[model samples]
Target chain A: MNDAAGKNTIERAEPGEVGIVQPRDFVSTGEFVFESGQKLPGFTLRYETYGRLNPARDNAILICHALSGDHHSAGIHTLADRKPGWWNNLIGPGKAVDTNHWFVICSNCLGGCQGSTGPSTINPQTGRVFGMTFPFVTIRDMVRAQKRLIDSLGIESLYAVIGGSMGGMQVLQWGIEYPAFVRKLLPMATTARESAQGIGFNEVGRQAIMQDRDWNHGDYPKNGGPRVGLAIARMMAHITYVSDASMDRKFGRKRTAAESSTAAYTFDAQFEVESYLRYQGEAFINRFDANSYLYITRAIDHFDLAEAHGSLEKAFEKIEAETLVVGFTSDWLFPPEQNREIVLALLREGKRASYAEITTDLGHDSFLLESEELYEIVRGFLK
Target chain B: MNDAAGKNTIERAEPGEVGIVQPRDFVSTGEFVFESGQKLPGFTLRYETYGRLNPARDNAILICHALSGDHHSAGIHTLADRKPGWWNNLIGPGKAVDTNHWFVICSNCLGGCQGSTGPSTINPQTGRVFGMTFPFVTIRDMVRAQKRLIDSLGIESLYAVIGGSMGGMQVLQWGIEYPAFVRKLLPMATTARESAQGIGFNEVGRQAIMQDRDWNHGDYPKNGGPRVGLAIARMMAHITYVSDASMDRKFGRKRTAAESSTAAYTFDAQFEVESYLRYQGEAFINRFDANSYLYITRAIDHFDLAEAHGSLEKAFEKIEAETLVVGFTSDWLFPPEQNREIVLALLREGKRASYAEITTDLGHDSFLLESEELYEIVRGFLK
Candidate 1:
């Protein structure tokens, strides 16, 4: 998320006029007083909410998303001018998230491009896009910012916090860094600590992004952003989202066309698989800010609760939230064993926890896929 | 394999000397006359040998290699200064496939570089490399060339034919294509038919190659030969070479010095892995003709013995050799199940066969890695 607050102040209101809670236009500022007594500002958080907050404001739920997912988690515009949110399927009047029962709040995380400030955002002091100048943010810092947002909204504690992938990193951090504040924790397809292997794959993607000639040290946004690097990065990442078997079952020996099938002639994105990945990259560039990718991935890499607590068992000792962790068997990027590891450690620590390893071969993307089984688990657990 | 006779124009062999089987100067050709009456020409063959041929020439064994491997299966060569073949760890004096007991022959396949003719060879008729003009060759074609070579050398039945990967493909082909020629077979890390998954991975590699502008429709020899495309291809291949666990164990979440690793800026190679793969691509260009990659891989893709016969069982019915099949437990690219399928089909056909699945975390690369167990198996099987 970008630090939008440090810029020329926008209308500062409770945003409660339209059944809103802190509905400010465009920018919201946040600050951090580090454990070392170092105070840092030029921080901000841009957010959105669905449904009404009860007078008690104790019904708020912080909904988190995976990489590239935005704050559009629910609700279609009543005015017929806006599209339904990304998670509209899961969050609605009577949907699984049950907007009528909870004040659903979803925010574009820090270092994000949507409405929040990120690499593409301007550095107020330098009059340049933040690019690499944006201070490196930690997962703890992101959670701290969210906590401030909640505080500003007059909420004492979150009814629940939910997330997946990097968002799951935040949920875990919220439970550990502010245990009492989170009533329920939901993390899917994530690890307590980004394994060396996980980090290695991310490093390669980051390198591919930075190595692109257009990256120009992140200053390329003014010239149209580093699309090629980002695309290449996305292409590399696209593979991790799918299982080898899936790729074969779909595109096996199937040429995109007669011309592009052979090795000798013009390749021209002819394979069905190649075409699919390119589409993912292109669509991604339109909405995602490359700078945010660096920050968010960095934040994820920084998250090591086990290291922070000196051990996995110790980390779970601090997670007081009733936990519901989910994973897929075919999630190679974050295999279910990671969830089992966390669950086992929590059990060892006598922490309230629930773990379920569903059998699926959708790979890491299973969480995002259309799965009745996954939804049932989420609904039943939350209920 | 290629129809060596059609692929390269030999200036004419000077005849066999005491220690040499006739030297093929200028260009070497090995023709495999197909049953289809399609007489594609310009054949070439690159080969290397080890051990002493008995006076009766009845003690010869053939060593085959996988895709991306060549005739350099043994012996130290001053020109290339490469190691003594890939299986050198398992093949040496008094070792498995011992130099003392049997004469061994390994060739670069017809479409390969090394001393053989391929995309880089000058067409005697056109005085230019065939490039895309090179005809698609098959495993049976490769075997046919070997049969001619064997006939030329006055050897009737070979003591054994041993190989892994594509080499293993040849072994399978030899069992069915000419049942009387080979007396024994050792095929490792291979399947009777290249699976749909295998084809998909290969397609990714081929796409990477064809996407490069310098590839120039296989005419890019002067323009650096699709180095980037080939690198990308190699990168994809590298991922398939090891399991997730091996990657985690070897390079998870670790970063080297900025300039020394992929994390920093550099036009030159950064990260040991990058350097390693770059070296692999550069060295490959020097010794390999890209056209051969096209033709040989096409051959592998074209190979489906079950499709040729009515079924895999029918294909295996002709096998007269004592079979020793080996598979790696973690070789996801050609997993144990694939080899087991082949072994099972052979068993279903009521053939004499032995199988072993070596436990290793090395993934598909186990065939190349040093394994004392493999040595013992080969030595004992031969005895």
Candidate 2:
């Protein structure tokens, strides 16, 4: 059952390395009901774990992921894998979330494509890919699914539940749903609710995907579907992930060497930023399912703590976890104000919550990018 | 040659109405060269004029247009017309532009589609639509062509040149290209150069159009071509035209009455903002040519005065006209800082220039929207 056991080839673990890890699946045959009142007969959650559980089983920490992220987060998938997991910089043997002292777990979100039962998964009843047939999911639904996974692992309580962006949404939901089950919550680069601007961006991305003829009403085979449209969406959304200042510093009017020499204008990517965006879009289509993108983004758009609980303050009334919300200075998507709103709401409820504003030019994706300040904050908050 | 003369059927002009106006086309048979070094054998400019030019022809005011704008600056096309010109509010009799005293002239830009010689026009050499074959255009090329039309009108100097957004680009270009030919300039809601973020947004829009199957490589039949893609582009761009605060105020999680009552999930536009964007996208496809959209946006992407000249100061060094650059407070697309930079450079050059910033939640399109502050700034600058 422990898939990561035999994969550790290193005789001596590197100081910050979690070493090679493998994803494992946990299947539950019990009926799963979504927050939208839709139900599935069963579900599978693919996850990766680091370190080991103590006798008391109370030292577990849950790692939730943002949109487009999944199970593998901290270690190399294989010894030959050139790139480590998405959050390898922070969660390791001696890293911020120190696997040495705490057992860490991260799962592919319920409606995710990375070995999780998502839109691309075959529907058991019809023997066909779920596609749009999959029931609508929400931040609460994602948190509940993770709760089941944690319960199955025999963990009675989580030492901490940490995430950023959509993961941050789940983090907030976890605090509300299982108030007494989680000790600490670290939600970063996210909002208590998706703003109109955020919803507008998501809507544009959804339109781009749906506009493609190849989408075939979300019935296309898993191997192919709306590549162009998905790429367009990704290209546009990627722009929102970084700050204007960061983009200018990185690519300011710099053209591809071949493009700069040509006087004739073509529709091809000319600016370095254009080329980078194109690459991002193309790379996204290779791993992401279009229907899952639609579902996840919709869930994000529908996420409003205030609307769900009647008000922002009421949304956090039951939260017992010590919360630390992180906001980035340049993250216009979920600006500092949005992040602070969560802490303010929690404080208003007389809960143990605080706010941290990181000054950075990385924009919304600041949580994923490496930073000493973020690392320190996460480390101290977890402690 | 005076097309607007017989169109005004109103016995008495309304207070601010310029009344009925007809678009006139001026055909030129002489070679017209583009900044890219390509040449057009001849071209036609569709234009409209309000009021009468004095015998000296010194009271004429040239009105340049933004992207997607045309010659119709004031008045209705006919007595039966339901809508007046795009800028009817600001460019009518006794309005800020004051058609009664200034002999206002507006034109469909050189690379525009509204009755102008553009991609949709039949190419003299090929006897077919130019499409992608249309010569690359620039802000300089547009100013040069407008100069020809102005000279043909027997006007030696313009009392003023006024425009916003892309039109503002033209106003700046006019000051540089014809230093002694324009007495005053009003450029608003524009930038001296497109920012990386601006370029990114434009690139996304372009990608959407090009990705459409019906785009037919910009060679599609005039009646049909990438309508969905064009609409998608318009929807995405519409978001940039407005600010976050404005969008929230206009559409804060408000759904269509029918959508709010439904429980099932679908890709249909549920939010009012989504419906509004879809309408904008649909409306744009009916009036705009995909090829023209490509060409005009390309022209905008290439406009960088600092790059063309050694520096912004150098770009303004030759300008002789008194200038006023206006920026809106909430225009994140081309923020006030960018607008202020133009005047800063002009001041560094010891040029007759100043800047005005109007506080508003209307975003980048504030210049087009009715604002007493903008109107006052324009009127005072003109005086």
Q: What tens digits encode model 1's per-residue C-alpha lDDT throughout A266-363? A: 33454566667767777877777776787676666656778678998998787788988888887877888887888888889999988977788778
User: lDDT (0-100) at residue B218 of candidate 2?
Assistant: 89
Model 2, B84-172: lDDT tens digits are 88888898778988877778889899989999889899986788999988998888999999998888887899999999999999999
| Stretches of candidate 2 exceeding 4 Å from the true structure | A1-12, B1-12
Give the per-residue lDDT digits (tens) of candidate 1, residues B42-71: 465666556666767788788877778877
Best by TM-score: 2
Span of ten consecutive residues with least summed lDDT in model 1 chain A = A5-14
Model 2, span A31-98: residue lDDT tens: 99998788999899998888877777878889999888998888887677898888988888878888
DockQ (0 to 1) for model 2: 0.69
Q: Which portions of model 1 miss their true places by more than 4 Å? A: A1-26, A31-48, A74-89, A125-128, A132-134, A207-232, A254-303, B1-27, B30-40, B79-82, B122-133, B137-152, B193-197, B221-223, B254-311, B314-317
